[model samples]
Target: MQILTPFKTITVSLFVLFFLTACSNEEATEQTNNTPVAIESGDECHLCGMVIAEFPGPKGELFEGRKSHVRKFCSTRDLMSWYLQPENRPNTKEIYVHDMSRSDWNSPSDEHMINAREAWFVAGSSMKGAMGPTLASFAQKDAAEKFVTKHGGTVLEFKAITMEILNTGSAMNMGSMHH
Candidate 1:
């Protein structure tokens, strides 16, 4: 058997390295694709077609799959509505919502978006979102409790949110009744 010359050895090693790097980059790109995308000016709600940027309160972004385009929502309510559907639940890759504790209720910032699964939500607050009554998302439980004390909402975890709360419009009316 003939041994490879130094030049040939170098070329083969470089080719292998290049191929490995390309594979690694592709994986990184896939992961990055799941990261939250900032809502644009003209971005419309995936469910209602409302102009997302024009609305106040926390917004949502959903990554359905590794290659799917993010589904944007004007309010966290809309995001939950979509996610609660039987067909969408199994396919969900990622869900993001603004941390209202770190964002303005009237103009949520993209930099404050957090993993929705880990967020605390205040429902039935006095605050109105894109869809009228909306769930105010927070990153911490204490922040949620503080908001409830001030805004008149019940603090709930992600799984605690239900379709009944969304459909009845009671979340919007909850704290308002006391006043």
Candidate 2:
């Protein structure tokens, strides 16, 4: 007589498949919920500029190096038009930003977060015009320090985009359409 183990084999395979699918789904959900979108440098902002945090796309970044300061932008048009200007530009090449993805408090960094070989910069604004709180970034600590020394600007980090910074002198001016 032969043993009937065909049913047992099929049951084992089904259980394995179900278990794998469940595990992968849980992992994906957890990752999505736990991280912010990645930010890039070159892409234009939804507002202003043609470089850095002002370049267009889903996300852009700005930095004023002296600290590890990094500012992530949301839209190209929103960022560039009001963000980038020679007067608004920080005077240092130490600032490094990306233009590949978007980021925020919810999605700060990612697995492939350090994409900087080809980076660009754009200016920034708190509101319509008339300037806002300017931040600086640096690649090396010493370089950033030198910049702060020469430019008289402040040093900052990537994790310091607080309401106080964004609200300085009403950076959010929703009144430019009448012009």
Q: What is the C-alpha RMSD of each candidate to the true structure, in Å?
A: 5.8, 13.3
Residue lDDT tens for model 1, 52-156: 999999999999875766899999999999999999998888899999898988889999999999999988888888877889999999999999999897899
Candidate 2, residues 1-70, lDDT tens digits: the string is 8664999889989999999999888766544311224445454333434343432222334443344244
The TM-score of candidate 1 is 0.78
- Once fitted onto the true fold, the runs of candidate 1 whose alpha carbons sit more than 4 angstroms away are 1-33, 170-179
Q: Clash number for every model?
A: 1, 50
Query: What would the TM-score be for candidate 2 when compared with the true structure?
Result: 0.36
lDDT of each: 0.90, 0.38
On TM-score, the candidate that comes out on top is 1
Residue 12, candidate 2: alpha-carbon lDDT? 86
For each candidate, give its TM-score against the true structure. Answer: 0.78, 0.36
